[model samples]
Target: MTLSEELLMAYDRQLRTDAETPSAIGIERLGPLRLVTFAGGRGFVTYQDLAGASARTISHWVAEALAFYRSDPAIARVEWKTRGHDHAPGLHGALLDNGFEPDETESIMIGPAHSLNVQVQLPPGVSLRRVSAERDIRAMSAMQDEVFGVDASDGNADAILRRVAREDGMELWVAEHEGAIVSAGRLEPVPDTDFAGIWGGATRAEWRGQGIYRALTAARARAALALGKTLIHSDSTEYSRPILERYGLRRVSTTTPYRWRR
Candidate 1:
């Protein structure tokens, strides 16, 4: 197999379990699906594959999964994560029929952490560092929410603060210009794995194309390397995909989230 193919297989085997469900309040299994409940009334569905089930079987699974989430009064929203390389026939139609709406697809980028640990020059007056204080974490979360086009909500900040309190090997990094956050991302080093995920990468519109995000990514990469993580991965949007590609990460697969709201 090619290097990219090998890496993709490793991702499926190593990273697609309860390891992906950190901070989850509870989890239940249905066939290959992991029904995860988070602290903020959010549910999530993901799996390694469909277990070679037929199209009709997958459709039935989808319906059953949605029903499971709907039965929970506390679950206000659920996201079903689909991978492009899976044999999940009829999943799209089934999810839509069950009131799920698809979000934009993202490239699953993977590569050695060292490939991204290069020196990146930030724009003038910009610096990068790790943040854990509640005020700094809230500011970072707010900026990310704005960049991602979501309303600035206290729930997000609260959720992050709770994770910070847990100290579960998750690190938040940000680039600041004159004491204001310009770009931010988080490093999650999976327990007992060779991989660390760089997630929630965002830069302000005004700061785009100035390398702030790249620097933040590199800083997180260096942190991962220090922790003995050999591999780095991310689900990257178009704006950030090219940057990661240039840093030697391969687009191993694609993932799209189907969201259902109550």
Candidate 2:
């Protein structure tokens, strides 16, 4: 197998379970699925594979998993993360039949952390730093929500605060211009593994085309390397995929999130 293929295999083997939900408040098992509950009334579903189940059996598992999440009144939203390389026959039909709407597909990019650690010139009057203060985090979250075209909500910021309190090796980084946050992303170093994920990367519309986001990614990559993480991974949208690709992160596969709202 090629190096990218080998790395993708390692990623599937090492980072597919609770490692994907390090901040989950609760987890339950249903066949090969891991039903996870996080802080903010969010439910998530993921697994390494289907264990060679038939299409009919997989459909049943889907219905059962949806029922499991639906039973919880606290769950406002559930996302089933499906990988492109998995043998999930009838999975798409099953999800749509059960009211789960598929979101945009993202590239699963992975590569050496050091490759992303190159220097990037920030725009004039812009600076990057690690944020921890509640006020700072809230600002960063709000900016990200706006950049992503989502309604401003405190739920994400609150959940992030809880994770911060746990000290789980998750780092929040941001780029600021004259005291206003223009870009932000997170670095989560997975425990007992060589991988750290770069997630929630967002930059304001006006900030696009500049190197601010790339610089922010590099800062996070450097931080991950400092924490002994050799591999960097991300489920990157079209906006960020090319940037990561430019940094030598190979797109090993695709991941699409199917969502159900309560």
CA lDDT of each prediction against the hidden true structure: 0.93, 0.94
What tens digits encode model 2's per-residue C-alpha lDDT throughout 1-262? 9999989998998899688889989999998889899888899999999999888999999899989888989899999999999999899999999999999999999999999999988889999999999999999999988988889999878998999999988999999999999999999999999899999999999989999989999999999999999999999999999999999999999999999999
Q: Compared with the true structure, what per-residue lDDT tens digits does model 1 show for residues 1-262?
A: 9999999999999999889889999999889889899999999999988899888988888899889988989999999999999988888999999899999999999999999988878789999999999999999999999999999999999999999999899999999999999899999999988899999998999999988888899999999999999999999999999999999999999999999999
Q: Once superposed on the true structure, which residue ranges of model 1 sit more than 4 Å away at CA? A: none
Worst 10-residue lDDT window for candidate 1 reads 115-124
Give the range where candidate 2 is weakest over 10 consecutive residues by summed lDDT.
13-22
TM per candidate comes to 0.99, 0.99
lDDT of model 1, residue 184: 94
Error of 1 at 167 (Å): 1.0
Candidate 1, after superposition: displacement of residue 4 in Å? 0.5
Per-residue error (Å), model 2, residue 7: 1.0
Clash tally, candidates in order: 0, 0
In the predicted model 1, the residue pairs found to clash are none
lDDT (Cα, 0-100) at 26 in candidate 1: 92
